[model samples]
Structure formats: structure tokens, C-alpha cells
Target: MTNSEQHTEHSEHHTEHKHIVEYGKYLFIWLGLLALTGITVSAAGINLGNWTIVLALVIASVKSLLVLSIFMHLKFEDKVFKIFVWVAMLTFAIFIFFTFLDYSFIR
Candidate 1:
């Protein structure tokens, strides 16, 4: 084959390698998150008072982060995207906090 053809082949191969690496990383992350979910569910079954729900939610949040970073490919995304995600999370947190406050203060 010509030199140009050889170089093109090498470039394509390099791109494929990078894609495989990314895919493998995502797969590993997904499996790990799934395992964590199972553990969290089991932990919830145990009696832990008011802290049980909080712990379960925290674990679910971590699992969500794994899905976002790996499955959704947010890890390599722009900072603007990260900011938007954080803002949304903060809004949800505020909503939950206020709801809990209202529940606690109810007569």
C-alpha cells in the first residue's frame, strides 16, 4: 500500500482504540453504579430512623452522578453544561429542603 494509505489506516486505528477505551470505561462505571444501587437498597431495608432516607438518597445521587458522567458522557463536556447540571441539582435540593421544613413545622 501507498504511504498515504498506511498513514490513513493508522489514524483510523488510533481513533478506534480511543473509542473502545471510552466504551469500556463507561461499561465499567455502569456496572459499578448498579452494584452500588443494590447495596443502597439493602441498606434501606435495615432500620435507621430519620437518617435512613437521607442515606439512601445520597447513595442514589452518587449513582446518578456515575450515570451522568459515564453513560451521558458529561465528564468530557463543557463547563457550561456542568454548571447547568449543578444549578438543577441545587434547585431540587432546595425544593426538598423546604418540603422537609414544612413537614417538620406542621401543627
Candidate 2:
């Protein structure tokens, strides 16, 4: 093979080496998600004013993170990718915060 072709093949093989997650880890994540879902449902039945929404949001966020890391394979991604995810989440939170602020003033 030519030098350029050899270099391309080598780089491709190098990047192909990725983390291999075990089945047990996936099962655990799935089970945790189910438990969180159950808790959220149970919490919904009892009213706690504003805290109900906050509690639901917190649990949803945790479940989302678990899905992102395990199901989406973000756990094996690079640091930059993880940072990007956090930035996106922060931006979303900021938007929600502003929206709530605007809503509260209207009431």
C-alpha cells in the first residue's frame, strides 16, 4: 500500500479502539431508570404545591443523565463532548428560568 493509504488505515484503526461496556452495567442502568419512573409516578399522587414540580424535574433530570451516559454511550465519549452536553443543559435551564420569571410577573 502507498504511504498515504497506510496512514489513513492506521488512523482509522486507532480511533476504532473504544470502550466496551458490559451487559451488567446496562441492566443496572435500566433498572435504575424504572425505579425512578416508579418514584415519579408515586409522587404525582400526593400534592406538595411547588415542590411537586421541583421533585419531578429533579428525578427526570437524573433519569435523563443516566440514559444519556449509558444508552446514548456518552459515558465513553470524549471530555469535550461531555462539556458540550453540560453547556446545552445549562442553556436550557437558563431559558426555563427566564420563562418562569416572565410568567410569575404576569400573575
Candidate 3:
């Protein structure tokens, strides 16, 4: 084979290797998150008073992280992308907090 053909083949192989590794890592993370979801649901049914919501939220946040990092490929993305995601999350939190505050303090 010509030199150019050989180089192309090598580059393709490298891309395939990276893709396979990423897929395997994401699969493992997804399976673990699924198991955690089951646990969270079970815990929620046990009547933990206020803590049930907290625990469920914590578990959901973890699952969101896995989905963002693995399924969305954010783990390998640029810092700016991550910052944008954080900003969006902060905005959502602010909206929810203010809504809760308004509801709790209404006359």
C-alpha cells in the first residue's frame, strides 16, 4: 500500500479505538446509574421525612451527571461547554428557589 493509504488506515484505527473505549465507559456508567436509581426508589418508599426528597434529588443529580458526561460526551468537551452547562443549571436553580420562596411567603 502507498504511504498515504497506510496513514489513513492508521488514523481510522485510532478513531475506532477511541470510540470503543468511550462506548465501554459510558455503558458501565449507565449500568451503575440504573442500579442507583433502583436503590433511590426503594429508599424513597421507606418514609424518611424530608430526607426522602433530599436523597432522591441527590440520586437524580448523580444520574444527570452521568448522562451529561457520558451520553452527551461532555466529559471530553471544552471548558467553555462545561461552563455553559453550569450556568444553565444555576439559572434553573435560581428560578426554582425564587418560586419556592414566593409560594412559602405569600399572604
Candidate 4:
């Protein structure tokens, strides 16, 4: 395609109107994150042995997902982009799982 054609196509792909997030939604998300933080802190106080780290990681993953989806605008993004992100995250998780597996065998 010519430059102008490519430019027009790209511009068309971009949303003309902005997808504005409502203030109330932002407030709710903020509150949820705050509550999760509190829970994480409370979880830290208890000793769950091997399960402690697992719980903490789970909470942290949830908090990260909230931030990533809302604050990072992943929710508004295209499916292709979201799929790429999930693939990267899955790869990272696999590496982490393997690392932990190796650590378990170390002792």
C-alpha cells in the first residue's frame, strides 16, 4: 500500500472517540486495590510455612492484574495485544515454576 493508504488505514484503526473511564469505576478499583493491600499485609503476619509464599504470590498476582488491566489500559486494548501479553505472562510463569521446581530439588 502507498504511504497515504497505510496512514489512512492506521488512522481508521485508531478509535476516533476516546474511551473514557468513569470516575466511580476508578474509585472502586482504587478501593479494591487498597483492600487487597490490607489483606496482603495481614497475610504476611501469619506463618503458613510453604503455603505463605503461595498465598502472597496469589494476592500479588491479583493486584498486578488489576493494575495491568485498568491502569495499563489492557482492558481497552485489542485482542491481538491481549493475546501477546498473555503469552508473555504464560512464558514467565513457566520459567518461575521451573525455577521453584529446581529450588525444591536443591535441598
Model with the higher TM-score, candidate 2 or 4? 2
lDDT of 4 by residue, 1-107 (tens): 11222232335456333455688988889999999999989998999898989999999999999998888877876777789999999999999999999999998
Each candidate structure's TM-score, on Cα atoms with residue i matched to residue i, is: 0.68, 0.77, 0.75, 0.76
Better of 1 and 2 by lDDT: 2
Model 4, which residues run further than 4 Å from truth?
1-17, 100-107
Count clashes in each candidate, considering only residues at least 3 apart in sequence or on different chains.
0, 0, 0, 0
- Give the best candidate by TM-score: 2
Question: Who is ahead in TM-score, 1 or 3?
Answer: 3
TM-score computed on alpha carbons, candidate 1: 0.68
Whole-structure CA lDDT of model 2: 0.84
lDDT of 1 by residue, 17-102 (tens): 12223567867887898899898989989999999998998898889888897777566565667899999989999999999999
Could you tell me which 10 consecutive residues in candidate 4 have the lowest summed lDDT? Answer: 1-10
Ranking of all predicted structures according to lDDT, beginning with the best and ending with the worst: 2, 4, 3, 1
What residue runs in model 3 are displaced by over 4 Å at the alpha carbon?
A: 1-21
Better of 2 and 3 by lDDT: 2
Q: What is the per-residue lDDT of model 2 for residues 49-97, given as tens digits with 9 covering 90 to 100?
A: 9999999999998999999988998877767789999999899999999
